[model samples]
Target: MFINYVKGLLIGSANIIPGVSGGTLALMLGIYHKIVYSSANLIRLKKVKEDTIFLTMLSLGILTSVTILAKIFKSYILDGSTRETYLNMLFIGLTTGIIFKLKQEIKTRNNNNNNSKKITKYFLFLIGFFTTLSLLLLRTYNISLDISEYQNKKSIKYHIVIATSGIIGGCAMILPGISGSLILLSIGTYKEIINIISQLNIIPCTIFGISTIIGTGITILIIEKTINKHFAKFLYLSIGLILGSILQMLFTITKLNVKPTLTLKISSGILFITGIYINRILESTKK
Candidate 1:
């Protein structure tokens, strides 16, 4: 239970980071399946006792982190353009590490039908590649649709918007390399959602939170079962998605033109090496 809470806290915090995914962290920590399966069975309260316990702990951690960290995220970390640049660089390293790790996983797995596996891999690779390319383009296209502003005008309308964002975020949370915060940002609710949480606006938060829980649970449940049944295909697609996102994020980060100071360059180098070291440590720990 304590372990699950720790895992959730790590993943929760990761999810809030602009370019990171809680699901990606969960996968790195070797708890993705457990977390997703538990979420699927969370509300049942009948036969799945262990899943319930783990999910309860995990939920507590995620909720606690969101309520507290969202404020810090909005106020300090992402407050300025300068800071956002440095942060994005850090996330680029994180995403790079994820791609490396996923690639390692794919290499370690042996599929009996090599040709079929290769074809499926190529198909999924294109899907992930094109999806990522489209999102990268959308960032600059900037056709402003501020759904949250509409919600603020009418009390009843707010519920509908929050619910819709929750459903989207919930599903995005499970997708490899896709950031829920980025999805919210693209939708123009990133600031509004954070502000609503920071203000302790209970009704809207509660409604969104519950809806997210339900949607996330169902989405992860289906994903968990499907991945378990088709490990090779899922692994290939996830790896491709991670690879594509890392490429896109690198492009985005480099274009920001935040010239790294000598100190910043040294720090980034340290972080990159540290990321590799951490992966090795995790691998040995599992051994």
Candidate 2:
């Protein structure tokens, strides 16, 4: 139970990072399968006691971590500084290590498969890579909107927009490489959601939260069914997306143009190596 909480905390922190995916972190932590299966079976009450306890602890951990980290990151660390650059580097390394871990899993699964199926996995990986790369490139040019202005308007249209954004963002969260916050950013609601969360604005936050839950539930069900039918293909595609997401994070950091002093460079290197080491440890423990 304590281990589950820790995994959830790590996943929540990863989710709050702009280019990191909670789902990917869950994969790295060896809880992805459990999460997806539990979510899919949540309503059926199968193994209800066990699933409830596990999911409840995990949810609490994620909620706590996200709320705390979001405030800290938004207030200080996201200021396009050397700190931000180093953080991105660390996460990139972490994500890269996850990709390697996933590759080994795929290789083991495919050991007895025919060459044609193996080739298909590689092709799907490339396809997934380019698909995510294209989406991230498109997101770079999204126009910023003044979300604060809509806060005062109690119009139904505004509520609908917020609800829709929440649904989309929730679905994005389940996708391996995509960040839910990035989806909100693309739709110009990222700031608005943050403000609502910070202000403890009950009405809007409730609406958004409900939508997110519904969206996530539906997405998880679909993904669970797909994985059951096509594990290798799905895994390969997920790996590709994870790799592409790391590339996207690096591109974004480069665009920030943070000049690295020697000390900063050395620190960043250490963090990167630490990230990889941590991931390797997690993978080994799962084995």
The model with the greatest TM-score is 2
lDDT of 1 by residue, 36-125 (tens): 666666655544877777777987888888888888888887654446555655556666667777777777885466787689777987
Prediction 1 global C-alpha lDDT: 0.71
Question: How good is model 2 by TM-score?
Answer: 0.93
Model 1 clash pairs?
A: none
Cα error of candidate 1 at position 94, Å? 3.3
Compared with the true structure, all predictions reach lDDT values of 0.71, 0.82
Per-candidate RMSD, Å: 2.4, 1.9
Model 1 — TM-score against the truth?
Answer: 0.89
Stretches of candidate 2 off by over 4 Å are 112-116, 143-153
Worst 10 residues of 1 by lDDT: 144-153
As for candidate 2, its clashing pairs are none
Clashes within 3 Å, all models in order? 0, 0
